[model samples]
Target: MASPLRRHAKLWIPLAFIAAAAVAVWFVAVPAESDGDPDYRDPTLPVAERVADLLDRMTIEEKAGQMTQVAVDAVQGDAVAERGIGSLLNGGSDALHDTPEDWAAMIDGRQEQALDTRLGIPLIYGLDAVHGNASLPGATIFPHNIGLGAAGDPDLTERAAQITAAETRVAGVHWTFSPCLCVVRDSRWGRTYESFGEDPELVSQMATAVTGYQGEDLSADTSVLATAKHYVGDGGTAYGTSETEDYLLDQGVAELSEAELRRLHLAPFEAAVDAGVGSVMVSYSSNDLGDGPIKAHADSYLITDVLKGELGFDGIVLSDWQGVDQISLDYAESVRTAINAGIDMVMVPFEYERFIDTLLDEVEAGHIGTDRIDDAVDRILTKKFELGLFEDPYADTGNADLVGSPEHRAVAREAAAASQVLLQNDGDLLPLTGEESLYIAGSGADALGRQLGGWSGAWQGTVEGVGEGTTVLEGIQEAAPGADVEFSEDASAPVVDRDVGIVVVAEDPYAEGVGDAGAGDHDMRLSGVDAAAVDTVCGAMDCAVIVLSGRPIEIGADRLDAIDALVAAWLPGSEGTGVADPLFGVTPYTGTLPVTWPARVSDEPVNVGDPDYDPLFAYGSGIQT
Candidate 1:
């Protein structure tokens, strides 16, 4: 008889041969079409000729319409077809459905309407897939960039990006707003987790890797387009200032000098552009360079002169949602300034009609020239041609099963496993046995709404009436089937008497900067009722604390020490169950810290580029079994 290992190898030998034969047969039977044409490079073609060859073939309204992007709820099939809206985006709270099939169907229906247009320019669908296609159900959610920074592996970062791209395309989305290259200088900023690391070099390198993984050749591959976003200094915004007075989380103003800004923040974008990124999204944050915050949107110097000319960027430059509105207090003036500044696409996500009217009126009134419109249109058309949307305007709905398929789930599972950092493990208490009676506490443990975080199912991160998601509680229950389990929010559940207790603590879901910084929102440190909850739970029984958050918070070393084990599971999306693999001994805890944990609130506003830098935990710091 063969040894067990030998037997396993012997069994796979025959199967491997069959797999190879099958692949060869499949490729031979279904050879891909060869549109073997020499590279066509013509820059001198008139914009009218280019758009007309594309547009003359298109009806009157279709040519005028491909320029607009509307929200999913606001658009009808007729409007999408007649107006020639070339793109659709799912903003905050917009979801096709909870399942992958539903998502594919939703996109297929939209694409069908788009093909009905005269020119049949395939509608480009986009979403903020910021952290692992967070909008799609069952899409793997990795730890935000801040956590990845602590892990400090460029190879791992690239793998995460590849997984994100694959899964996003699986969901029928071709464009992803990701790899935010902002070098976060302040933790108080809401979008801190969106950045890879605080170091400009690190952010640049990681951003380039992510862009590469998303693929530069969209024409031949099903890979999605990667966008390096919030172009300029959004992370260096001064505290207490925001673009809108009603929400502290909206676009704010950066306070860096031009030299510092370029040296620290702008460096990553340059790297992204060089990597052949498909698009660049302008930041809403105001800069002091020449004009001001709003001017950055339409500033010819920055958008045209700097980004396009100096940096040699050739991709689409899109504004943030309704970001063009800030160009001026006057609606028409705002449209004119932004267009003249160099915006190629307007995400007039809401009220697109007004934007269209304003742009046309401005041109007729001489406030904005037709040449400027032609320039913007030319850039937009060039990108569409490059993306090969002109030839193939439809997605492969026959492969609809690809959405959230097993392959995607496997990648997401790996990311989820890699992203969790074992912050503390006293007495080596982790890898809880399946037989152990686990008592779970905190709102995050059983709540899917809390686990999904901001920009999911809702614009403002509100989870109410938002539909369904897998919770940490469900995950633990599934991992330890038939094991005694109990949950409580008040810390008074009888399950505390169980053999082991797990307390899952999380911040109220929020996006941008809406979550308060001082009192009500969240403090880096475990304080107020949260601290009280921890203290109460720990005092009642032996326990481990798991933090589910977008950013690391300052927790007293003593408090962290008191818990038997501590895990940083940064916003693990619908697959909260994936977290159980590490918790229940199925997978070892291997994720390292992606960002430093602050020992105190005063330690914050710490930048990796700071001269006097000292951190509670160093970047790339993590504990593993």
Candidate 2:
């Protein structure tokens, strides 16, 4: 194979499109305030000026409120208006209302509460629309980041982000906590699927998501705030060091020299900052660069000195869910340490009121200074102003119909097709003609939740009514309209001489620490049932095995020898037809391996640059049809 990066360069968005999509809204215009409204409320004033004016007029309680973010479910009636809460987020829970209209209505009601405040500052709503409007059932679910990394097309990534932004904005969501830029070093990390690849360059290249989400003008109707998350080094943590219960590496420690930390984990964040991302979310992980392991939330050197001072990131430094609480046993110290470390806003979630009162006490007691509070509020208000929330606080229901529209699904289908990496194509077995009598087996063949993996309509991806989309079976049937397509859930039926056999072996849907392989009995291999299905089908006839998983699963040498062909179909989200496209020659296989596929489960940490690197399929190895 030729250089994967150079081959992918041809598919990048045209230079004209890049310019048109540039984040020019990062710099707002400065003009004289209009006569009618206050200077802070006037749309004509510069964002910095408006932020300063608002900061001056805000009471201490209001400023504290601006620095606090709580979950939507925790708030009671009129709590937002009464307490002057700054922002609300849906933290991996079901939507308050199912339809886009209802979602928008709910958020608009909350917006009215914020607008009724003394200063009339609008509230910014956020959600984990990491892959599409994931909280919404009827939104188009694009392939996860690992799949996009295999697809290796930044232009496609940008387009997907654009669609996600448009769909999320229709439901009155002003912000999305997405574009996870972690350079995954250990495959055992549960959030491996959330990263682009194990390489810094690839993760940096995918930062085009920020541009796609923000667009040229953040004030544009389609735009939503993009957060570059798990700041610093969440991906480079050592195994078994996780402080989180029942996890091997989710929130573990990155014990490395400062040079190694900068080289391995800092590049993607630098690229995100250069992309003019709206905010940066601090990681729950800790890092030990010579001194000792210090939580990123409490590490002033990493947060303030490095991310803000060195990278020149003026955007809000937001904390993860209860991220500050992990810094110390004492809640007040945890709050004080995180705030003083330059975290602009805290995701207090349930304990928001306590957070507000505690923050007020800290400021009153001189534990935290007024200047820091003002600075945090300044960043928070600047983003709110940039999002044009002051001018238009309500949701625009014009694009509500586009939430799960066929047009967006078409794009997702194309992405799913492009992301299929053909690793083993012995005897040239793939690109099956439509005329072949096909027998499809295994659970992933018809399972939508299996294809979507995690972070779908819920925190963990689910199979039931995760909106509407094609499954592998449906896609195959559609691709071969006239061909006889038969299916068996486990290949339990006696096999006849079918022209071809395709078995889709899938990992169970999971997210975060629970997905970590080393934490439990998860050996990173195919389940016994899936393995038996593969053997039963391949033993009787020619077969192609599609491993549907978040990361590479150990297939073993015997399983590889049995199958005529193997494809890594890393969690293709809602568009299973994309998986069928390349198999049927509708789209050629161009995706390369994003991570090294280990020959055995024992080769756990194998990577491209390692001295003893030996893999069943090396990184960047993918067969072109």
Candidate 3:
């Protein structure tokens, strides 16, 4: 028999080797940490490893809290630290503003409370900077997406996003709910202006906005996370399906075959993912892919199989505001279904505690698997780590001066010029001499609020003091220094008594869930006053009608014949001078129609590739002098 010492050595040597191998595996999964103590706080480690370590340290409640996003107003009474809320969002319209400096203070206070939490996770704040840093007081409001779509210049589009990102960071926001990638197939859809037009290819090209938002290094001081929103198809909703009271196409059903859906709706998201978009907000609308109307917020095939498994989007999947609540009658089951469907973050804008409790209880009951919870938290925490919020959680207050700077306004002007589409110019009426006595009159002419459209200073973009910006009349006057310029909100004014008449008509400001044209039933006709304004003004003078709207409306042959020129100036935002730049020989007319100009509202759903492809002005139609 062997000696006792020899027998003990053999057993101890194998045990030591096993322990060493396990340690090696841990290091490989995580990045190298200092002193080999498995420290997640080590800055030198890869983000994945740090995320893994932090995730492992979190309890179920902490992890669930990291998945919850609430409105800032709801964060009352120790909620930020006590509840471990992961993020905060100021909706399209929020009651939070004292000054630019106050915005920073508000953000920093919440951040301090977040840092005081058990795990010290920072809260990411999001807002709708759709145009510029739109909701902010001094930030430049770039042209709405429809204008950019008509401009069709990806470079200009990207530049607009870059300015938006820089200005948003200056205002203490970490994310922007912008670059609405919904390919608008129907102009009647209330949210048509939010899209990049009805082409998958165009939307895909514009997805470069992600690069401008996050920059090459996501952790850069000015970088804000880009969101590819209304995932799947919010734009393709079948008309008349909206359940919203007094709302139409905003959240209607998307009725398309899987092939059609894949071809059109999913194209931009693929590009967005390729461009490294950090988040995708699931649509509130439903989709019927040859089966039945199923909400995208809880569709396992849409959220999990297609978005995650097939496309390989590793970013967090966020739900729209109160989106999960609408998925099912039983709120608890809605939480379970959305989680299992691969939503990593819940935008329970209100009632966040209920959302957290339901998710926590669901996980404990085995209704939501532990693996799912881990995956959800993994994505959310990974983004926070990538954002470098751990190393620097406070607002970079120095950037505050960047808001609405002259340089940024110059960029917005460039976009506004590039986005100006010349839809009609009969008798070479454009390239305005500026030498001609010009009469400018219309409801939208002098109204900056109407020019900027919705999501400006307030939710619906009320026309009252819609932030600082030059009005269209002011811009035209600047362009036509040689010509006598006049402005009148009343179209019936004697402005037609001039060498050339310029009439501006506009759709009233509207936003999501409210602007729908009531199912497919559209009155392609312009609003009564505006239409009469066109006839009253154009019928008298050699006038050029500038339709300042989100999308095309009915301008019948009779109406069309009344004007010597027509320009589709889709919601030109704050840079009104950019519109003048192209009109008065300062810049050439280069933009083309993004959407088909229908002859009548009866041509309810006309598009480029439709079977009967007749349009008042074909897609890509633009006339230059």
Candidate with best lDDT: 2
Higher-lDDT candidate among 1 and 3? 3
Can you give the lDDT of residue 104 in candidate 1? 68
Write model 3 residue lDDT over 125-172, tens digit each, in one string: 888888887777767888889899999999889988998888787667
TM-score of each: 0.81, 0.93, 0.92
Using TM-score as the yardstick, the better of models 2 and 3 is 2
lDDT of 1 by residue, 379-482 (tens): 66766665566566555545445545666566555556666788777788887888887677875677676666776656556544144345788888877786
Off by over 4 Å in 3: 1-38, 93-95, 241-248, 495-497, 519-524
Where does model 2 exceed 4 Å of error? 1-36, 241-247
Whole-model Cα lDDT of every candidate shown, in order: 0.70, 0.88, 0.84
Q: What would you estimate as the lDDT of candidate 1?
A: 0.70
Better of 2 and 3 by lDDT: 2
